[model samples]
Target: LLSIVDKLSGDSGIGRTLRLAYDFRNAAAYLKYLWFSGEGEFKSFLPWGTLEPDALRGEIENILNEQSTDIEPALAGAVEQARHLKDAYKTPLAVDIALDRAYYRYAARNLPEGEYFSRWMAVMSDWANLKSFVRVINFGLNRKLFWETFAEGGDIPAGKFKEAIDLDTDSIPAVFIHTEYGSRLSDVIKTALGGEMSGLDLFFRAKLMELYRYTRYCIFGPELLWAYAMTKQEEINTLRVILRAKGAKLPFEMIREVISVVLE
Candidate 1:
């Protein structure tokens, strides 16, 4: 993935955004290293983006040495959010949410206006927020935490999300009635409310496949590459699930339920 991203023209937005995505992942891992008291093998980290290994080491050392203010804005923002959560809630889950919010924020900020990728990012954010809502309700977690974990720049307003929490399963669809995700997710929301966690993934993957199909009509541009990348990722995920199910000697029917369909 790193090599592919590197080979793309410097002007390519998709390539630039992909590198940022990996950098955000690496940044999260670096924060995890600090949270664990630097116990892990630092050499095992997959370094990418503008941060070289030596530079990343210096940044990490600076963070540990109380010079966090010098760190880059994107990473520093994520670390600061995690730090606040640690001081207050002291939960590892909060750190994950912080990094996720940072990543989406970075993507939304960097993506060009009037592009399909920007629209896709909005859809992605909505799906993420929806998943967070479902998890919070299903686990009986505090509703206030939803605002902290929510990623901005989605088509659905944050206020709508806040309002949706108070809604019953049947009423949740009304919150997104005019949006693209509404029809696709309505049945999935009902199933998820009934405690079937996998239903959400099923709905998300199906909707994503539908979106990817639309990208096929683009004759030239980043959308083609982006669609291909997303398809490959889904294929890889499906394979992993299949292999794991086979290793466990699960029946085909049971295995089929957990795997997503590949759109050709």
Candidate 2:
């Protein structure tokens, strides 16, 4: 996997940022795993390639203090910018938008290998935008603040996402009807209205997996590499979520909803 990341990330700092994103993910999962075991279901996914759960080092938040030197830097700049925006806006939403934009922008740039992979990045962006729009409506977020989260490189128009804020549930899906998510927007809206915001995220996640599953038969190419990476990340993410929810003792329905996505 490291070799694959290295091969794909050879384009500027984008590849390095990809590794850094994994570092953050693994570290976060390790910490949560520790919290669950009070020190240890998660043994397999806890790769510990970076986290060092037994070392008991300082908090992983320290990753935020990393310097972005030209010789070696990942998503540090993006992380720092997100931190700044978080402080300025007094909302975590800024951080979410900033990091996501950086990750996608870099991922899209790094994958010059195939247009299909590039389109994957674009669809992922659309999902992010669509999900953010759902959150804006559900949480009553500031109208102007939603624009800050708008990302480029997606089929969906920025204006369409902007117009969705004033829309009710019945009317929101129509805004995206002409775009990549036209057929799926209905379910996105239905799941959002079903009262579980997490479900909306899972809905898109399942779509990405569906999108990539067809490429597995490819004997060779960056597409296969991406498929494997996406599948692995899906495992890590799903397990991480289930473990956290279990550790927190959330309801079974919540876990079941997420598990269903993975099962599909």
- Candidate 1 lDDT, tens digit per residue, 1-264? 546754753566666666666556666677766675578466655555666766766775666567854545877777677777656655455666677788788767765555687778877887788777877777666676677778776777877776788877678766666666666567777778778868887777776777788887887656777777677767878898889888999888986755646744
Task: Give the TM-scores of the predictions, in the order they appear.
Answer: 0.78, 0.68
Worst 10-residue lDDT window, candidate 1: 1-10
> What's the distance in Å from true for residue 136, model 1?
2.7
lDDT of each: 0.70, 0.62
Task: Let me know the TM-score candidate 1 reaches against the reference structure.
Answer: 0.78
Candidate 1 ranges with C-alpha deviation above 4 Å: 26-61, 68-72, 167-179
Q: lDDT by residue for model 2 over 182-258, one digit each (tens)?
A: 66766667668555677568767887888678786766566766676777777877898888998999987867767
TM-score between candidate 2 and the true structure: 0.68
Record all residue pairs in model 2 with backbone atoms less than 3 Å apart, i.e. clashing.
Answer: 9-15
Candidate 2 scores a C-alpha RMSD against the true structure in Å of 6.4
